[model samples]
Target: MLIAQVTDPHIKAEGRLAYRTVDTAANLARCVNHLLGLKRRPDCVLMTGDLTDFGRVEEYRLLRRLLAPLDVPTYVVPGNHDEREGFRRAFSDHGYLPREGDIRYAIDDYPLRMIALDTTVPGEPGGIMSDERLEWLDAKLRERPDTPTLLFMHHPPIVTGIEHMDVQNCANASAFGDLLERHRQVFQILCGHVHRPIQTLWRGVSVAIAPSASHYVALDLDPNPRREFYLEPPSVYLHYWNEGSLVTHLSFVGSFEGPYPFFDEQGNLID
Candidate 1:
């Protein structure tokens, strides 16, 4: 089984730029086209979040149209940029997103028991997983203790060296980590929000952050007063599950050079 994780398109209504510069919608459309053209389509697309810029109704509507080309099953969770009510309203037919609560749910399809965690706190940039939400997660994990699970959320558990982004990281990370300690079945924790690709050992489990299709957060180590983003190459993660373990590969978006085979006519190396 293979899964693709795309994050943080930050789309705005129609022609508006995401931050008055980046063409987020166009970037997202390109990514969707790339996914559709892949030799092996991802069994599912785990859209981590920031589906819109201001969580506006129009923005979500535009997003649905931009994402219309994706034929694979998609599971979405929210980021700080997303509003719960608006997200629920737009994605109500997903059948898994709750009609009136934090958007948390699980996908039991394929071999992996995929879990989506709601970490976005409506009016804040930082994330907080409430006690009620944590309890729900505990129950879900307990119900399928032996199944290989992949947990998806918008906020990352570890603090990347970027100080500005770290300040807005999950506020209840310690509590969240403590909960994951008991569920060894959780093989991976996939997330978005940093707007860049990152990976680390979090709470004794593997954790990965998919790069945004819009713009990338600059990889600055020093603490800047404001966050900075750049037009770095965007990418998505293709996670392949073989046997019992999962392996993830990063695919840069947009067209590049070529596949150019190196072998000659008789399978000999070409100089």
Candidate 2:
């Protein structure tokens, strides 16, 4: 199965631009088009978080419209920027999402089981793995111990060198890691809040953070780095499950010269 992961579109309403610069809606539209134009279309799309800039109803409405072009099933979790109640209301049609409380659920329709975690704090920029949320995940993992499972959330549990981003990363990461020690079925954790593509191993499980489709957090590793973003080349993460393992590919958005033959018409290597 092929899964397309698009994160942090940060859609704004009334034709507004994110950070007074990036045209998030347009970028997301292009990203959506990119996904549709992929040679091997994904079976589903996982939108990790930050679907809107302010989590307002209008923003969610616009976000829904922007994502309407994607024909494949799409799943989403809330990020710090997303208001829980508004987010739930926006995606009410998605029956997988609960009507109240944390927006967490499990999907078993495909070969790879997926469990979505809600890490958003009500009015904060940081994330947390509270006892309630962790308990829910533990119970879900227990139900299918042998099945290969994928966990999708907004905040990554690992600490990247970017100090600013790290501070707002998922809190109680060690506790979460300890939880993973028991659930061997969880092969991967897909996340998005960092606004940059990152991969690492936590508790023997693979964790991948997909870059934003709108803007990217600048790659700064200083102890007191500036909290800034750039309109980088937008992209999406394509996860392909092949032969018992999942492989992820970073597919950049926008048009570029390509398909040039590397070999001559006679099939000889071009010199």
Candidate 3:
């Protein structure tokens, strides 16, 4: 199955740029348009979180309009910047996610099972999975014991080696990792929020995090308290699963504008 993943759009109600610098909403729209222009569209689009810069009704209205051209299904979960009530009210009718508190469901088609978890802790920059969510996940995993599952959440369950981000990561991630260790059917875990393409292994399975369409977290591994991001090319992830293997490709939107060198036709000459 083909799944297009978009994360941390951070659209504003006023449709303004983030931090007075990055035009997040416009960047997201450009990314979406590029995805639509693809020759082979994905079966569905999965937006991990931070759908809005602030949880405003007007922002979601704009988001819905921006999402109008998607012929395929679009699914979303709340991030730290998202208000659950606002998201539920705005996207309730879409039928992509369960019409209830903080989405949780499994896609019954194709040999794969996709589970969306709510890890957003309200009014905070971090995340946590409540007991109810944990119970639900355990039961759901048991119910589909044989199906290879792909778990999606906004906060990644493992550290990304970036100290500042690591502090604000999932609070109950260790427990979640233990849960994954017990459930062998889980094939991969996908997430957002680091604002960069990060890959690591947890619970014997691979976990891949996609970069934000607006800006990227600066690649720094310093132990300092303060951290920052960089203005890199906006990107998305295309996850392809077939048979028993899964591969993900990171794609950046727009053409390259840089210098290049070419070798001579003789194949022995320098650039």
TM-score of each: 0.97, 0.99, 0.92
Q: Whose lDDT is greatest here? A: 2
Total colliding residue pairs, candidate 1: 0
The candidate that achieves the highest TM-score relative to the unseen native structure: 2
Candidate 2 local lDDT, 1-271, one digit each (tens):
9999999999999679888899999999999999998889999999999999999999999999988989999999999999999999999999899988899999999999999999999889999998888999999999999999999999999998999999999998888999999999999999999999999988999999999998999999999999999878999999999878999999889888887998998999999
Instruction: Summarize candidate 3's per-residue lDDT along 92-160 as a digit string, tens digits.
Output: 786766766666677777667889888988899999876777888999899988888998889988888
Better of 2 and 3 by TM-score: 2
lDDT of 1 at 107: 92
Candidate 1, 1-271: lDDT as tens digits:
9999999999899889977999999999999998999999999999988989899999999999988879889999888888889988898779878777778888987789999998988789888777888899999999999999989999988889989888988887888889999989997999999988889998899999889988999888886745779998778889999999889898999888997989988999998
* Backbone clash count, each prediction separately: 0, 0, 1
By lDDT, is 1 or 2 better? 2
Q: Show the colliding residue pairs in model 1.
A: none
Those runs of model 1 whose alpha carbons end farther than 4 Å from true positions after fitting are: none
